[model samples]
Target: MSRISSFVEIYFPGVAQRFQKGIALIDERYGVKAMYGLFFNFCLNVSRPGQVDRLHCLPHADYKNLALAVCVVFVYGEFNHKEKCWLVMWEAGIILQIPPGVFVAYPSALFYHFNFDISNLEVCVTDGADFPTPQNSRRLDGGASGRGSCVWFNQASMWQTAEIGVDTIKQAISQGLDATCDNQAFLDSLVFAKIMGDKGQPQPTL
Candidate 1:
């Protein structure tokens, strides 16, 4: 089997009406696996260490051999990278407008960062773990060292949060399901395909 080292984003349409059901479906589809959702009321600030406060890279690569998938319901912000700016996209097209509710997904491994300028926007994050360990090295310069102690961030630990559940995730998505979210899912899926080591699949040049 190919090594899984990327993230995936899945988008749900009409998320408001089907938020809770979706979570339930995911749970039923992938049982006993640790699933988590993070909701943000305002636009999130995701930047390199010195660039922003709310944004920070993890100490080590997550899931070592798996991918992370994020389902965003609403987006009132944009993702800023070193080379260019990416406006979140929906199923229809580029997400230049922000609706009250939108859903989008994307891989978490690509070399990119995001920031939100709007208030009260919500984000739902669903993740799985393949292996966990303590980090032997710190992310001093925006890069991770391959060797280090490792710790596992498993399902039990994630479910401990009150805000993480099918209902909560669904609520966040129903709040916003726009084009940006759709585009994110597409980009993320591309990354996921690569990590899965699909033969003949084109990988992102980054």
Candidate 2:
């Protein structure tokens, strides 16, 4: 267990179990779990600390050791739903400006969500792509990485907020990604749009 995980478990016993139960509730209420066609692991884990915000899509299948998977992100920011179908996908939508200290548990693989410009953050949660089945028809960018969520950002928003200049843009490009390079060009397009936005010009629709 990570130092953070040990601390949480010792100081906050049953919290992981509570979240698991909550996922069950989400399944009951929105059937997010049913869409995966398999069960998910609620083994709480600590996410790597990040100071910047991100937005991206992902697939939950194969999140952990399971054949298929899902995840719940407890982030203090907006988590928008990319897909529309409830049973086949997470009940898709967006919750703007999510307050701090709030937990948003979700099937990170099943739902493509993004983070707003909330900074100095640490996301603490567990990998949940435990579904045992074939990959879904719509494959998310960084689903295989088990990092859940492409960490892709909304272009207009990222451009408007990050204050990313030529140097920053160059840096993100050098890494071959804007928050989620692993997702490839399909996701990188958002960064390009943001760059265009910085120019005060209309970005071409994807």
Candidate 3:
């Protein structure tokens, strides 16, 4: 996992630093202890790897939670963008060309995307990840074989997690905030918020 992270950081510098900061922010904001999990969360695939559409081109499809993409070789694939409908970029049903080394960064989870079929010779490798997304990540550093074993701390039971998200707290109340949210839960929540609020002023040296 570290090797893969290093390789990806080669093409996209500051990956480790930026993502490390992002992970910390998520953990802080959501009152959850999270880590990279240090896994290959992307794919290095061939051109037109998926099935072609009726038009014989890789039709408009949205990539969920994608952040960036890079074409390594002669991957000259055309791309089209649509918000909620099928619309070409330049001409009537035409798309924009993607030259090699012309890296693209976008929030794929928020937009619809279209791509044309690439020639067999044009191989591409895309690397991307969503930011600030919350997940129950395991403590990889403390485990043998670096597999999922230990959690940083039981967020639900250990941390002041009732203050994690307002929506979650409300939902918990609506459904059942029981077994947690004891008599002192409200004070604990407020104190937790105050402490975290006072923080984030100075960027801590990692």
Candidate 4:
């Protein structure tokens, strides 16, 4: 996981920095603990018990996620990556062929994305040691014969708390204001607010 975090920071430096800032603010103000000592929360997805989707997901946008935040998705399985699972971004008309054990980072809140169906594809579990594996592996068996993904991201509410010092929706509700509209307005204000841009202030040394 540390290696994965480093990989993301290397490829998406700006996003990683923004995430760190937001997480730091929240930690100081609200005592929220960072997941795995990082700014992003993690989720693992896998095929249902006996049912096949093999992490093949439906098209959807994470509407309530931080607008400018990037989601780092790590794809893994034993299927043929070349012909099997692929990430599709509907808004950009982009289909990413993500090889197994590789990471792809994108702004999930801004795009409708999903994975290509891999249920119909046969799983080929290899023991040839051709697949990437941990250095401490005891057996020569290859990757798992089912698709799964590890996604790391920040919820918009986390950023909202970091920025406003409180949950805006709850505050709005207490004041008898429309929570939904207030939340949307607050999120719109942050869509391009530049969380890390220099604004006549000293930048923290990372």
Candidate 5:
């Protein structure tokens, strides 16, 4: 079993574009939002290579919850954690354009980091439930290979006990499990462990 070191969690919701466009127009025309409301917790790292000063943004450790809607206007950074490497992970729906008048919460986690470069992009974050800290607290200091593992024992058990579909199981694993172990059996064991751990008994096989 792999131990978790550090990780981050980001939540996105579906909304309409017209509403987002109107909010964007308001932000562009008046600049009042930036001055009065909470700002985006992420920063626009212009020093990175191929990073335009006004085209992207990056989330830092300081990303607390704000009170406005926000989206990833653009993405350009190195996923390999190498020097001068730039990539765009989100293309279409991956970059969510949120509208105003919505409740958005940005919780702080172990892997609290993101990158973007854009202008007039606004978002609000607010505090919610108490943040969860890893049992072994440490910062991630490597490339994609350096990601910490995520273990969802109790929840995984509940889902499997309900005999959820395989696709649902896969999706839950992708979101809750560590990204490193993408194999089928490893994922199956994780789900099984989650269920058995909750029941305080050994995992049973058919």
Candidate 6:
């Protein structure tokens, strides 16, 4: 997790700073790291060796997560990433071809996203093919081939508490802030800091 955090800090410095700010706020509020205070969590998609039906999900938005914050996902494992595990984003109308050990960050609360099915295509040529099968997919140490994702995100409640002095929209409204007027203004005031790239250019957005 430290290494992944460092990588994001190096490449996506703005995102790293945003996460750290949130973490600091939460830690200060609770006087300790909460049980779910971690910036990243692992989800191992394990299955039978070479199983083409590995775990997946339907298109959905993570409504409970912070809307202004981005979710960072790190995909890794021994599966054939080239043919399988592409990320399908409905709002973007694009399927991202993320190779193994790569990291992708997006606003999960805004985009409806899912994954492609595990590849079932058979390889005809061996020149540069990545065809993992039951017989050859197992590691020498007998570990099964599978995929895993590490997701980093901030919960909506944490940000709400930090920014609005409350942990829920209802609480904020009850405290005299109008949801459609003052709430949107408060959200607008909480802008992400602009990040400049090494070449003096603004960082690109997804």
Candidate closest to the true structure, highest lDDT: 4
- Clash count (model 4, backbone only): 0
**How many residue pairs clash in each candidate at the backbone level?**
38, 14, 0, 0, 21, 0
Give the lDDT ranking, best first.
4, 6, 2, 3, 1, 5
Instruction: Encode model 5's per-residue lDDT on 1-206: one tens digit a residue.
Output: 11110111112221112223333544565442322112212333333334432222255432232112223222233333231122223322133332221222322221233432222233222233544345423333323321111111111222231232233456757667432323354324322111254668765321
TM-score of each: 0.21, 0.21, 0.28, 0.66, 0.19, 0.66
lDDT of 3 by residue, 92-152 (tens): 3344444333333322323344543333223332233433222522221211111111111
Which is the winner by TM-score between candidate 2 and candidate 3? Answer: 3
Q: For residues 1-206, what per-residue lDDT tens digits would candidate 4 score against the true structure?
A: 68766865766565567677887898788787777545457898876646764566778998877776577788877666755667889988988888878887788999999876343444443456677345423332222247778888778887765665556768856777554425455344442212344676543321
Residue-level lDDT tens digits of model 6 in 69-174? 5677877777666566678889889888777788887879989999874343443223335686665563222122477666777667666666555666798889
lDDT (10s digit) by residue, model 1, range 1-206: 00111111222222221323344444565453223332111133333444442332332323321123333323222322221222333332332322222233432222143322222233222233534333332221212111111111222122222223333445555766321224455344343222223687565421
Worst 10 residues of 5 by lDDT: 1-10
Better of 2 and 4 by TM-score: 4
User: Residue 32 of candidate 4: its Cα lDDT?
Assistant: 79
- Overall lDDT per candidate, in order of appearance: 0.29, 0.32, 0.32, 0.67, 0.28, 0.64
Please write out the lDDT profile of model 2 over residues 102-204, one tens digit for every residue: 3333334345444322221232222355543344223232211112221111122222113222235557667665543233432332221112566787654
Runs of candidate 6 with Cα error greater than 4 angstroms are: 10-12, 34-44, 48-53, 118-145, 178-203
Query: What local lDDT score does residue 51 receive in model 6, on the 0 to 100 scale?
Result: 58
At residue 177, candidate 5 shows an lDDT of 42
